[model samples]
Target: MRLNRRLFLGNGAAAATTLAAPALLAEGGGKPRVIVIGGGAGGATAARYIAKDSKGAIDVTLIEPSRAYYTCFFSNLYIGGFREMDDLGHTYGALAANHGINVVHDWAIGVDRDAKAVSLADGASLSYDKLILSPGIDFVDGAVEGWSLSAQNAMPHAFKGGSQTELLKAQIASMPEGGIFAMVAPPNPFRCPPGPYERISMVAHSLKQTNPTAKIIVADPKAKFSKMALFQEGWLEHYPGMIDWIGEDFGGANVSVDPDAMTITIDGETTKVNVCNVIPAQKAGHIAEMAGVTGGNWAPINAEDMSSKADPDIHVLGDAADQGDMPKSGFAANSQAKVCANAVRGALTGSRVFPPKFTNTCWSLIDTDDGVKVGATYEVRDGRIAKVDGFISAPGESADLRRATFEESEGWYAGIVADMFS
Candidate 1:
């Protein structure tokens, strides 16, 4: 039988699959069990794909805390008022009913690797033949001075894309007219490299429409950012004299915030702000650490199949996995999940396992109908996922092209979310 995988990727890109193994019974006198932690793009895709492709040969369970997951990908558009929060929200009800997968809405607190089991916050344990960890990202403690989980309400990071996104939007809307909005950008190697800049553009968009004279200051540790020229050009053309981006060369590297006092200090020079957005340094989610699969901040994975380097039975995907050359993106996570799903299913069902091919595209909307993107195809080589070929939107593109790009992004969002939940 032939399955055209292009349906999963919005762009009709096909990935061929082959199966090799004979079907096997469950882990213990039943269907083999696969426990997936995190119900976001990676984990959800893995669980659904495994269960769907296994055809009753394997049992899949997903553990996630949030009943409704808000995607981080196009969240900036929501902030810009291009979309509502509900537009980005997804649920696992489809996974439960349509796919016949077990969806557990709980926190996975521990992983007993030796016992091949996961412990839940509710004091229940689940045994699995294979485990998938895609717990996303967590902030590095003390990475930003004067910023902690306690200060999140005051300076919403809005990076995780749920209530935080709403909080940040409300804060922006409530900013005093002509007020100063400051952002402390995270360091390199963080999730969604272009996210902060896109957010700045979106915030500027909102501010321009409402508080026209409001100013924005971005204190960034990196001297340059993803699609720098493109974003800079767009900012200049769309919102001139409204943004002041301070790179590390200008002391943006040394920064601190006073949440209580509503002040930000860069290079010992403190300035009060109407609203502050602090994006701290990030690492693999805590569950990856609890699973004892993390190396420093991220869980190392074998690029060939997204399996944890520390434990072959455990696979890591998304922001948590340190797979070389693949950005920590929802699209990349979904791509990795497909490859991982194939491998896991192959091992359990003796299905034909084809070589893995991955693709990713990250699109950022600068303003209404103005978008830019970067994308690439990847392959595993020499123990790392390396870029094979790539393309990017250039700085000076026509309005029609930019509009088409944005439209393409809209279609991709619809496609990816459906690929995950529906």
Candidate 2:
């Protein structure tokens, strides 16, 4: 249950108690300090768990640029008119007031691993005994030819949620009658493996209502995708003729776009389009590389405790981690964070540290009241996270089952935000 803000902040007594308990330090030993960067699923949950479980034993500070975070997981539904932008937004006030975390809304510009200090964009440097990084993803440059960040406004990727999602929604709403919308899907090893396909479904859902004559074309570099069979089947049933997916076999991999002309070329054929969403290949967030933790595009981590293989004092989580078996979804991040928190607290305070076990579930909304899911449980095997069991929703399932799945996703979204913030 969530505590009411009024009661929790009554006469500001509880707030004052929390204010005096948190310390921002790393030098001497009043309390062991922990610094976390990127306050999304992994970073926020880790900070919350460390502080709450320690019961003020640890001084936890979360350094995040954005005070309000927009989740990228179900952002496709916002395009389909199932949710509002505000629905996906969360703030960090509860993590500070309720969990005794020091939430710093500032960018982490540099990390001095030798000194165990992080330099913020605001010119302040802080030290910590342990550093946790979950900075998510940054796209590879020129991964999608003829497209760049400068042209993102003209041909929106909308993959990272927030303003880009709003831009895509507005562009979709403004499309001329019988217009064309094209998506150049990113290659594998990106955030949310099933995301681009789901976006296609949601776009089709929106156009079916507002502009039934409009069309969606996908240029995918891979022959198959996550939940390919289920999405294909759902498209055939709900959106018969609106989608055309061009796989790599047909030169989908050979593609380019023109933001100025609003056109896309596939298989040497150029056609004008009303909107083009280009999701480029991705890499770990720049901060990870800057910290000398990432060996390549992603930071390798130990499955036992989600600690960076390069530096055990630094842990990587969420989309930025190259963990085996587990998909880089929000659920996976939260699970990894808990394991990491338990391990870190044990290292700092000699608490009981349980062996790490992880799980992740990805839910995609195909159409109204129609949802599909894929998930797995994982454990350490041979020093890597290995799948123990798995489950996925089968095609041709009953309407009742699909609706229940969608409802489950809604509950999860609510619960996760509360878990992260409250």
Candidate 3:
């Protein structure tokens, strides 16, 4: 029953079943309880694996406010008209009915570490042997001047990828034929580093077809960005003379917006725009802060187990955890969730705990059938998740290769969501 990193990496599903069957596979005599907060990729995957693998021996409860969860991943594609809203939404019915999970639609207001209990907004409490928090990201208040949650409708961040995404798409579609679309990109260490730029690509794609005369401008605070050369090349090739990207060196660092005026000022130069998308700086979701697990803006965790450094009984996942080398993407989150699920099940059931191994790949669509990706495999080293090997799409890949890559991403989206929700 001794499990190692290779077993976890090469045969994860089989390894998880083996570890979970040792002490927990049958119901009846006072089972171990696990409560998971949030229902995103990380939370859903962890909850499902732990519950399904352990059979009825683990009483699993998933506390999520939304009944239908829409993914933030590939949300840019929705703006690009590659996907529909209904196509991105998922339900908790399967986790409840098929997997025997207690899916509660409620807010987790507080976590009492010493008591090992979570207080819900509905005036009820649930105690647990282990608590999993995958609360996602929340914007830092006043991170972007003149833009707050109140102004989200006027200038959508669309980072959450639900109604906000839909609103942004509608706004872009409704712009005047020759209108100017401006974006205020977030600073570094935000959720999905390449997100805003990919969004810009999608917006440009839609406008290029319908309103060929329209323009796009980005005011970014970072001097450089993820996949900068690749995205720049794509912009030049697919939508030439359509996008203007201003980096920090070119006064992109100095930016502010007036939602009411539909304007953005960069380095004392103000320009009026017909549509604005302002994505602000971010931090871990507030519930993690409430749980006292956050260090600065994110929660710290043990790379071996994804357990909160602040509390052994609590684990943090996804964008909320400050695990080095892993980007805050849904793919990374799902990968970490599987590793965490294995460790948690092992700890609870006296099963063999495996050395943690993880992987993530982030894909972006430049245009129709044009795709690019960057990815890496990781292992625990020096008490942090360190990248072992990596690869990225080159600047001048063939059209057929790029199209094949895009097809690969589409298949991945279908696979990961099914791995998480179904």
Candidate with top TM-score is 1
User: lDDT per residue, candidate 2, 1-422, as tens digits?
Assistant: 22233432231222112222344333575788999999998999899988987788899999999978999988999999999999999999989999889999999999999999999999999998999999999988899889999999999989887999999999999999999999999988889888999999999999999999999999999999999999999999999999999999999999999899999999899989999999999999999999999987999999888889989899999999998988878988888888888888777877667768787889999999999999898999977889999999998999999988888788777767766788
Candidate 1 total steric clashes: 11
Q: Which ten residues in a row have the lowest lDDT in candidate 2?
A: 11-20
lDDT of each: 0.91, 0.88, 0.88
- Those runs of model 3 whose alpha carbons end farther than 4 Å from true positions after fitting are 1-11, 20-29
The digit string of per-residue lDDT tens for model 3 on 13-122 reads 65465443556532234678899999998999899888887776678999999989999988999999999999899999999887899999999999999888999999
Weakest 10 consecutive residues of candidate 3 by summed lDDT: 1-10
Clashing pairs in 3: none
lDDT string for model 1 (258-342, tens) is 9999999999899999999999999999999999999999999998889999999999999999999988899999999998998
- Clashing residue pairs for model 2: none
- Give lDDT: candidate 3, residue 84: 93
Candidate 1, TM-score vs. the true structure? 0.97
Residue-pair clashes per candidate: 11, 0, 0
